[model samples]
Target: MAIRITGTGSYIPSNIEKNEDFNQHEFLNEDGSTINHHNEVIIEKFKAITGIGERRYVENNLNTSDIAFYAAQNAIENAKINQEDLDYIIVGHNYGDVKHNTEQSDTVPSIASRVKHLLGIKNPKCVAYDILFGCPGWIEGVIQANAFIKSGIAKKCLVIGAETLSRVVDKHDRDSMIYSDGAGAVIVEESTEEGGIIAHESATYALDEAHFIYFGKTNHPEITDQRRYIKMYGRKIYEFALNNVPAAMKSCLDKSGYDISDLKKILIHQANEKMDEAIVQRFYKLYKMKMPEDIMPMTINKLGNSSVATVPTLYDLILKGELEGHIINKSDVIMFASVGAGMNINAIIYKY
Candidate 1:
């Protein structure tokens, strides 16, 4: 009765624009300094502070769906499961290719549908949909997929988390340098396997302290009041996460009848290297167990913050042999924790 990740895959843009590349572009600040610049001094500082060396980038014309298409195809092939077996395709994305049409244009559904046609999955029951959450979107997608499977509504689900963060990123802002663009996918199927998604728990604190990060441009009191681009009071969010994420992790671990020591690896939302280290240090002090080494490299550097795409992309990196000898193993207990806009935090335990 577990949802097993049968296969994992990712699609990074072939074009990698290093921080230094941005210096040549029109991305500059008011004081005539490079806004998205990354020279030797800046790159070294970024690596030292965030533990990120580089990030992926797509051309200006491409959109989120295009990346998701490639990622889904790779996942299908990697899993060796016939595309016909996919009864559902659920996507977690902060930005779709296009928004607000009379139809589902430039969205995940259209992307999945196109892939289905290409792969020859003709069944009408094989439907696709999208889910929106900040960084924790992928976790929410998996949990929802699990519910559909448990209720016998779906036989197999393609759960994907992808983003074209550069599309919304304010390139003129230095804070946006920590973000990049990419996509990742997972093939989740109901199985009798002993290890998979053991427990999932989430918490959404009232946006009393930090709600300014939510971004949208419209002024409609109902829909546009929230800011549409990604913004955060870094220090405030960091303190909140340091306090909340560990508690949520403890809650999920307890539900699964496991402890931090039982976990073989931990994959947190790769938002900031500094924040990740801060949380890991706290955990080490409390439990004396070593923190998962994956805290760095997943974000704040390469691929920047791909928003919802971070976890699944990191998951794919593990599967693609990038982290093969480190941090993960067969049947190893893995933990995923996320903190995003809406000031929400969630944690889940899984096994591979």
Candidate 2:
């Protein structure tokens, strides 16, 4: 028996926010001081470093759970599974649902529960819950589903990673440009398939890096309102990921007993282009080999960083032939990795 991903789906918002959209805003430093550089130069620098030309935002009428439901509906339809037969619904998210133009988040009923309701699954045995593992949430959800199947607790699971980072961002901060909204999902179940998830790794570095990425007041400190937004120490996160993520990926691949040469594609978190490139390079370095061209597929240029949604969204796009020049064939070996708040890092080695 193997824990196989039977189907995948993602909901990419239609509302596009381009790089030039911020040209008229007043970018501010952490200390509330105005950035001396012109908006054009700042945006250019951001684009060059993150490779993000545009991002998507949810419609004002929609919320995170709504998008999660959409992705879940797609995955269920793709998998052709009966909703009543689902054993679990696991949603990976950071901020719950932040309505448009609101500083408050609503999590009274968990996103998973809301999604399950929206999906119209009435089975009482269909357990549902949420996880807060930063950007690796979707990968981690898959790992959890694998565990449930391997332990005889579940037969089919719906794993979703959804977020509305745009609602939680400090517009005055430059990093705000990196935030977007999206949701991706997959149906995992026990199957007599040859290729499936083989190995995984997870770690949290909270000792000194606990607050590397956090929720705090906006860069415009003059606004005395108690509203807090998503914030991070980009340099610290970059260094933390570079120093540790590659090693985690290596460990996962090694545990899977697959040689570096067997890795066909790496669907890494769309955090930053340069940082992701460096991580893959370092990962290849561990095996004394050069990183293969087209070995890593990316969606950051158009999607920005959608917290938990990045990896699964990228995987969904490639699997559906929506991402050009990227394809996953039967029995292909691949890896999914991500790093984010909690200073957390994780990787999953899969055959498929």
Candidate 3:
């Protein structure tokens, strides 16, 4: 049996946080005073480097599950399937719901369960759970759904990638601007035809570089808990991406018996524009050919990095014809790849 993505949907919060807002965003010194830097210069430099001018942030009134529920509902509607037909609901996330006032992370009942309840899915047979594998969690969720379908365990499954990363990041830190909030979802169902995920490859480089971007304290230990917020060694992660991501992508293509020429578009993680461009460039070099212009689509400039939500959201836009000059044909091939925290990397190849 073959597995196919029948529908896709995404939700990005309406609230936009511009880079200029960070100027007065309380970047403080140890004793609670401003750390001196030309805020305008920093904002411009950040835009030039990451290609991000603004990103959406969920308001205090909302939670991760809320966004996931919306995305899942939209996906179900798009797939033209009855809600009761869903056999599984798998959510990919890093931090569960975080209560801002209490600074608490809650995972006792999985976010997927809450989403299932809110969707009014009353089927007792529909399994729902969460997965954590750094930024690759969503793709991993899809991979597991594939196993379930191919093994005759499921007929239809909903895979969702949702994150409210702004809640986990220290607004004062330089890395904070790269994180945001959003959710994306897809309906994967058993198909008699052969136009779905053809092949995939993934791996983890368990090293200190893995810790380069992780959940940890603010640099000023006097102010907050030791493992409270997100922090990173940018240079270390940049190096790791350049060294590992392209190889994993190529390995995935090879597994599917494909070459660079076979793919129409490549959707990569929207973490850093500079790094994403570099990774694709390196992947083409492995074939001794240059990547075609406009072959890679990016949303990082506007969406920032919503962790696992990025690629699925990008795919949803393309499918809806919401992106300019980006469209898929009846049998086009595409590749998706990403690398992030865990030093984890993953790739997927599919036909449309």
Point to the candidate with the largest TM-score. 2
The residue-by-residue lDDT of candidate 2 on 281-324, one tens digit each, is 99999999999999989999999999899998999999889999
TM for every model, in the order presented, reads 0.83, 0.99, 0.95
lDDT, candidate 3, 232-309, per-residue tens:
788888998999899999999988986679899999989899999999999999999897998998888888899989
Those runs of model 2 whose alpha carbons end farther than 4 Å from true positions after fitting are: none
TM-score of 3: 0.95
Q: Tell me the whole-model lDDT of each prediction, alpha carbons only.
A: 0.72, 0.94, 0.87
Candidate 3 pairs with clashing backbones: none
Model 1 agreement with the true structure over 1-352: per-residue lDDT tens digits: 8788888888888777676765533434424454354445555665677666677777666677778878888888888998877888877887677432211225634555655655567778888777776788888888888778889888788988888776665544455567778888889899887888889998777748547365533222233233354445666888887887777777788898887667776777888888877776676556666565654335446667787888888888876778645557688888888888766777778988
Candidate 3 Cα lDDT to native:
0.87
User: Candidate 3 at residue 314, lDDT?
Assistant: 93
Best by lDDT: 2
Q: Which 10-residue window of candidate 3 scores lowest in summed lDDT?
A: 26-35
Q: How does residue 260 of candidate 2 score in lDDT?
A: 93
- The Cα RMSD in angstroms, rounded to one decimal, for candidate 3 relative to the true structure is 2.0
